[model samples]
Target: MCTYATVQTTLEGSAKGPEGSWFAVTDATVYFDHPVHALAEHTLNIDFADPAKGPGARVAVELTAAAARDLLSAIQEALDSAPAELTA
Candidate 1:
């Protein structure tokens, strides 16, 4: 089993394709802002389809430039509030 530590956050949105409406708890998504700024933007986009093996996995990350930064920053709040344990 993969350690939960790898996942810095969990996105509770809709994930389309393959898995259909399933929860997707993924690892951290690290990236920079721009070529000029380069490493100036260090953010991670963590998310999950659902709390369990249910529906709601039908989402995608569609952003542009600075918008990406905003979306990532916004997800930070969810990360800070996610639990480190599996729920029953």
Candidate 2:
């Protein structure tokens, strides 16, 4: 079953896309749905994009549920271990 829930937010960052090129990412779109390329039936999908640049200026990732949870944990750990001043 698809949750059909999506979360989008504005972000200021850079993401490497095709051809080993980097682009400024101004938005993030996260959703859980059927994978476009992954073999899994359903996966967590994240898209970092710069809408002003066009649809091609984007980096996408699709991860299995387990992997997504692991990534979440790793992100939290990395943030937790960082210096408060740097993170703040």
Candidate 3:
């Protein structure tokens, strides 16, 4: 349910970024699908999943496409509704 190939960390980096994907497990069920850019097409399967470490793996971004859009909308709405003083 994720894109990319295999998202990993070196125990000394932030698990937060669009390119630097990070997951917690392998068989982790995600609500949305992750687009993996491989070959000449976008794959939606785990080509490199390390279940030994954890079922939750990061193919790419942590948040799915749907989640990112929802969050961005929420933040924009909040900002639009916030007072001018606070924003300034």
Candidate 4:
């Protein structure tokens, strides 16, 4: 079953895309849905994109549920270990 629930937000960052090119990313869309390339039936999908640059300017990731949770924990741990000034 697909949740069809997507959380979209604006972000400021850079992502390296195809052709070994880098682009500025201004949008982030995250959702749990069917995977496009992953072997799993369903996965957590994230797309970092720059809408102004068209569809090709994007970076995507799809992770299994377990992997997603582990990634989340790792991110939190890294943030926790970093200095407050640097994270801020």
Candidate 5:
């Protein structure tokens, strides 16, 4: 079943999009739903985008639940291991 649960946030970062090019990512849209390309019936989808640059300036990721949880743990670990001054 599709959760249809979505969340959006403004972020300051860069993500590599099409053609091995990089773009400023200003927003993140995260959702759990059917994936457009992933073989999984449903996935945790994340779209990093720079809306001002148009639709092409975006990077999308779809991960299985287990993978998503692992990613979350990895992110927390990386952040936690960083110097407080740098992370802050």
Candidate 6:
């Protein structure tokens, strides 16, 4: 089942693309849907991109529900452990 529910946000960061090059990622699009290549039937998909730099300047990820939850927890843990000044 494709939820088609998408969430978009502005981001300030960089990502390494498939071409082995790093690019500034200015936006993120997250959604739950069928993946393009992952083995999972459905996944939580996230695309980090710089639209001004064209389609190639993008990184995509697809994770199963459990994996996505784990990733969220890991992210929170990392942030939580960081020094307040560093995170701020």
How many pairs of residues collide in each model? 12, 0, 11, 0, 0, 0
Candidates' C-alpha lDDT: 0.42, 0.94, 0.46, 0.93, 0.95, 0.94
Ordered list by TM-score, greatest first: 6, 5, 2, 4, 3, 1
Rank by lDDT (best first):
5, 6, 2, 4, 3, 1
Q: With candidate 3 superimposed using the best TM-score fit, by how many Å does residue 78's alpha carbon deviate from the native?
A: 0.8
Report the Cα lDDT for residue 41, model 5.
96
Q: Model 2 misses residue 14 by how many Å?
A: 0.5
Q: List ranges where model 3 is wrong by over 4 Å.
A: 1-61
- The clash number for model 4 is 0
Instruction: Give a tens-digit lDDT track for model 4, residues 1-88.
Output: 7889999999987989979899999999999999899999999999999988898888999999999999999999999999999999
lDDT by residue (4-87, candidate 5, tens digit) is 799999999899998899998999999999999999999999999999999888899999999999999999999999999999
Per-residue error for 16 in candidate 5, Å, reads: 0.8
Q: Write the per-residue lDDT of candidate 3 for residues 1-88, one digit (tens) a residue.
A: 2442443333322233234666443332233344544332333332234455553444343454455578779989999899989987
Off by over 4 Å in 1: 1-14, 18-61, 84-88
**How well does each candidate superpose onto the true structure, as a TM-score?**
0.30, 0.93, 0.32, 0.93, 0.94, 0.95
Error of 6 at 18 (Å): 2.9
Q: Cα deviation of 6 in candidate 5 (Å)? A: 1.4
* lDDT (10s digit) by residue, model 2, range 1-88: 7889899999988999978999899999999999899999999999999999888988999999999999999999999999999998
Q: Give the range where candidate 2 is weakest over 10 consecutive residues by summed lDDT.
A: 12-21
Q: Name the lDDT of candidate 5.
A: 0.95
How well is each residue in 23-56 modelled by candidate 6, as lDDT tens digits?
8899999999999999999999999999899887
Error of 2 at 61 (Å): 0.2
- Candidate 2: how many backbone clashes? 0
Query: For model 5, which pairs clash?
Result: none
